[model samples]
Target: METVVDGTGRAGRSGRRWRITSMQVLCALLVLAILGQDLLREAFDAPVLQTAATVFVAICVQALPFLVLGVLLSGAIAAFVPARALRRVLPRRDSAAVGVAGMSGVVLAGCECASVPVARRLIGQGVAPAAALAFLLAAPAVNPIVLVSTAVAFPGEPAMVAARFAGSLATALIMGWLWLRWGKLEWIAERALRRLPDTEGRDRWRVFAETARADLVDAAGFLVLGALVAAVFGVVIPGDWFSSLGEQIVLGILVMAVLAVVLSLCSEADAFVAASLSALPLLPRLVFLVVGPAIDAKLFALQAGTFGRAFALRFAPVTFVVAIGCGVAAGLLFLGGVR
Candidate 1:
């Protein structure tokens, strides 16, 4: 059974509380528009609304297909790739293992949220914690949609594409290595891998369907949570915040990294947020992009619940450093000088 929604009314409701609330808020805005007229227009028509819409749509479009892609690949891997085979493929040494693990994301496409369960399932099936950690960080950023969106975000900067991919890969691998050396697997939640009650004896197609359906169901609430966060970030956090940071580029990047961790916006959608930081120069904003997929508040929360605090504490900071370094290099190459 799909955990978020089971192809039923309750499930659908679980998935799209925003569509409903959006209507409610929009209707209220319309009412305010009629009664207060110009006042409502003045408040609602502020640039913030436009900016929010721009960032919101960018994230949703970029993430949804990739999320679907990731979930499907994860499903196929679970249903088809024998656990024994996976165990063989994942390397044993820490750095090499991380490299092998991180590269696995090259084939799977997904957002950070979607990547979590897949990683958990892999671990359950005996894929090393090192490899699983790498996959969790990589699957979101290196996905096609994320890279393509990076290209879009930078307009003519083809290097942005390379930067996003390389940065995401570097962070994931290095972080994986760190975790294997210093982190433990005690962080993953037990309830995360429970089997669905009635799906046995099904065909591969059915298995895939069941997996995808369950993913969509399980992720619906999270999707709503992400959207609401984007919506709120839309209303709060003025653009001047970035502009005001001045020359604290490293500090700024670190701050945004923290924000990325907290917000846990989908990889697809995070680019627009990074772009809107036009005031913050390119490097830090790039760091925002790089750090986001690997560590975000939403992602951290999920990880803590499913992967454990020990894993998170070790994994998050190392991933942050690697990603920031990548962003700095990319900025020097493409952004001229973003110090």
Candidate 2:
């Protein structure tokens, strides 16, 4: 009987060791894709398929650099910046810290992919969750890099850049204050709250490298998924949707807002995508830019993984609603009633 039990335990251990991983499945799929390249080429002969492929490549290429930069910065902050130092820099009051945190996004330029891990790290390092959350929403949308990209994308409409900045900043500030008022600490995962060991000398650099690598790995898969979804939607969504929405302002805003979440375009690249939709009025496009970096499918996933599903479920929907309202208000103020 003992021999039988030992044999069963051994078999169980062996089975666990041989269990398939997501990475292995991905590699197998990649190999099959490479082997069937000719078939894929033929399949992509359809205009819709070709368009989807183009969009996938374009989004991946455009966003990856910014994503990389964001992770690197996040790593640096995690490694070099002490919790005490951060505490000293921000106001003692959470409400005041929220505003400062939102404004700080102007200097700390990064895409939404970078913000999740960074915010989680900040929370772990003893920063107020509200302040960190504010930074998460603001960094991607209000950063100089994103603003400059918006300006470049809409050279003829300088107001777009201003509107985007104002809208995004407002969303961050409002969310931060709201979190301060009602958010419970228990909603965040214990893993996110656990502080990293403080390291000195060469160990800090090692921490930086490890943190950045882990963050990149964690976030990149979701980024690819988001790009795929966006690409598929790009082809599936008829061109007539844009042309017809011009006359239906309310419908246009709602559609564009939903598209923003579904597309999950990088904050830096979304301005260009919005600019390409010439058929839509300025208001809907502004909503697209503002809503995207604040809460999208990818961002929602990142938040869920980093902060906890409870936090994400509550936060994402509120952010989406806040972003739309802020976007509309900014559009009216800056674009003069969305002309």
Candidate 3:
């Protein structure tokens, strides 16, 4: 009886520890801000700090709605759309199926986080791995929400939207074809290839809600981090770097490509973050958009877990190179040789 009571007390303590939620953290931060208001105000009074704060707020405000929308649509796809249905729609020929999969991304609006599981399910449902990969690459980048957000973010640069779409679609198709030609099935993990049963009826809504709630929590944290990084870049980075690199476009492209991988911004929110970096020319920013949804640090981790490290190691680097090449070509063609 004494052992049982002790075990119960320990379980209760563990439960309490697990209950320290994000909301609790946020409330604690809010309380600290209130307590330290005078100190914060004096610190933020610096012109650079003030600018950074403004940029951070602006990015969060502009990107939040789209982020919410992306997650909701993602949940709907996960709940309503069955993997077998997607497999049924693909053409018998692998090449044609890849094209169809790439184009299909326009209708299936979701962030990159949502695409991975769906792609895994498609593969398990007997869809061609190459075609499933094409969808995974394209869904986050070419969807209406992302393009519309890009249009809103850039406002007047219609070509930015066009270039992003063309570049992302091209990257998807190219990667799919490459996989068809050279990828090994054994590279994917046995667990990832296991088929999942589809959700049905009333259970679907439960899934939709849970998936949306979980994705919003995960993506929102990353969105906030991306905004903070953009804010710092805008104010903290030396102005001369942007100025000098603007003249050396190749160096600018390489830098933005690396930033895209490192920042790992959500597709629905990356545009606003990219737009905040007005120091760089349009081409580099376009590369940031194209490469981010294709592969980033978080995405590499996700791929490593889902497809296995061997697959991710080979696929991510190739996708990065292909995305950059497509981004540059599309920018030159659509943006007319970089602004």
Candidate models: Cα lDDT each:
0.68, 0.82, 0.93
* Model 3, global lDDT: 0.93
Q: What's the true lDDT of residue 81 in model 1?
A: 57
Better of 1 and 2 by lDDT: 2
Off by over 4 Å in 2: 1-16, 19-23, 110-114, 120-126, 152-156, 182-202, 217-235, 265-269, 272-278, 301-313
Worst 10 contiguous positions by lDDT, candidate 1: 192-201
**Reference-based lDDT, residue 97, model 1:** 66
Task: Kindly list the per-residue Cα lDDT of model 2 for residues 11-30, writing each as its tens digit.
Answer: 22223346888889999999
RMSD of each: 8.1, 4.0, 2.9
**Candidate 2: residue 104 lDDT (0-100):** 85
Model 3 lDDT per residue over 116-160, tens place:
988998998889999999999999999999999999999999999
Decide which is better by lDDT, 1 or 3.
Answer: 3
**How much is the lDDT of residue 274 in candidate 2?**
77
Candidate with top TM-score is 3
lDDT (tens digit, per residue) of candidate 1 on 89-141: 87666567678778877766666766787677767766777787888888878
Q: In candidate 2, which residue pairs clash?
A: none
